[model samples]
Target: MTTAQAKTFITLFLAMLLTSCMVADSTPDNQWRIVDEGAYAADVSADAQLSVVSGINNGIHVWRFGEAQPLFQWSHQSEGGDQSNNLVANVHISADSLFAVTADREAFAIWSLTSGEPIGFWRIDESSIRDVAVSDNGRGVLVGRSNGKVMFFEPESGRRIEFLGHQERINSVDITPNGRYALTGGNDYVAYLWNTDSGQVIHTFTHPSRVTLVALDDEGRYAFTADSQQKSQIWNVQTGEPISQLQYIARQKIFTDAVFSKDGKYLLTGAPSRRLYLWEVATGKQVGEWKVAPRENMSPPSAVVYGVGFIDDKHVLSVSSSGLAELWSMP
Candidate 1:
């Protein structure tokens, strides 16, 4: 063959090989369904039985894993009975799946999972609500605000506890299944594990940049904290000591959501780049990894992994901003 023809052939082959690799990496080994076509946000219950999604219009829908239709549809409305103009930016289901919490920037509402009805709705007056968590059975509610305060409230008793440790906007928060302890992170570059009743800090985890994500193991075994920069560490909840740091080769690996295994042996984390990772709790080694598919005809061909949970010992599930729900076999 002529030299020019040989060069052209080599370039074409290289392009084909790159394209094939991209396709393979973006496709999951197993996908369950497209839970929501264009959901703004989504969250999965810790037991993996149900999922809650926020649609473009800020309406909320709850779906059982095997069901085709959502069990409930709800929307936040104004006092005049008109739909609120704000979009629902976050939705989380309780560990027991008995209730869920949805929050836009200015308000949050609790819903009953069984009856599919609103339990109560509350509005924030000072600053926007950045993140929220509901303990099992909806006995306790926690919200992190843009004004650096985290509030833990009981709907039945009208008791409230405000945490004023953070000096900057609160970014993430989680509570124990029993609603005893709370884990929170903030733009002040700190993660605090504190008491829900006293609001006294138990342990302070410092980071180099803003702490963007924090999670507590439902069993109270471990705590996971990550910053906007490169540092991510797992801590022993009882001893208040660092267990191990997530060892990612990337300079920065930002986690949008995380859940611990029931046995506390493994952790599942989701990232904004459609990346889901399974890590060993003791070693912090990445044992498994998967990439979720992007939205159809997306310009950048990327999706944010909104939530992840363990379906069972052998399988894990993830929901992405692309509105896709997938089940994956653990490695």
Candidate 2:
């Protein structure tokens, strides 16, 4: 072959090899089991024993792993006098207690999962709460509101502890295991760490773009945040030092939600484009990617995955904007 032809052939071969690698890296080794469909929002508990999903006619449905149906259902609004509710934004479960925030800027309510009765409800500021995080011990709860505020509440005492920080809508909030510090991320492209007891801002980290999500590791030593710019960062919680940054393929828009595995060895991130990525915490390497196909029976994809959480190191729960929830086993 001519030298010029040989060079062209070599280039084509390399291009094909790179394409194959990308495909292989994105394929999932395990299958996704759909637990629920048509859910607007969903959350899995820290123990991974329960999942709460809300959307449309479904209100809030609580399910335990391996169960065929929901253990309990709660609605905010009544339909046909049958007690139907709508517009649930978030749900959280701790032990036998369940907490939910509705779409309307009204109140946050708590319920007893065992008895299926309302335990109590607290009126939050008339701003829509977008996300919430509960302390590992379930003593403290942090609510992120649309009005750029983080409200700390002690669920057991029904007392509001603090209202502080953020100049724009808070997208996510995370509390450390010991309940000493809380982290808030907002549309202002900043993430702030605050002292839970004193309600004081300890340090603020700026991102290149809007902050979409924030999470703290099990040991509370590392803080992770991601933005719409497809960049994920890790910071040393104690010194407020940047540890590492990972970039993903950019999309038109990405709802970046991240979680640290139970072992704190892996970080999982979900994007808008039906792709989920797992990263190694120590080496900052991409370990796996799961590709979810768009629902062939529907007009669009199953739904843009809103959040991802590790059930253990081997299993994960992914919730979509359309309210479809799934559990995947990681290899």
Best by TM-score: 1
* Count of residue pairs whose backbone atoms collide, per candidate: 0, 3
Residue range 1-331, candidate 1, lDDT tens digits: 9999999999999898777544246455566554445678889898987888887643777878867777888876556644655688878888788989998888888999999989998887788899999999899999999999999999999899899999999999999989989999999999999999999999999999999999999888999999998999999999889999998756788999999999989989999987888999999988888888886678878888898989899988888877778888888
In model 2, what lDDT does residue 79 have?
29
Residue 230 in model 2: shift from native, Å? 3.7
- lDDT on C-alpha atoms for all candidate structures: 0.87, 0.68
Quick one: RMSD of model 1? 4.5
The sequence of per-residue lDDT tens digits that candidate 2 reaches over residues 188-307 is: 999999987788888888988889888777566689987767567888888998877764443433545666776777878776667677888776677877765443356754555655
Model 1 misses residue 59 by how many Å? 1.7
Q: What is the Cα-based TM-score of model 2?
A: 0.80
Task: Flag regions of model 2 displaced more than 4 Å.
Answer: 1-37, 77-86, 94-104, 136-138, 156-158, 247-256, 293-296, 321-325
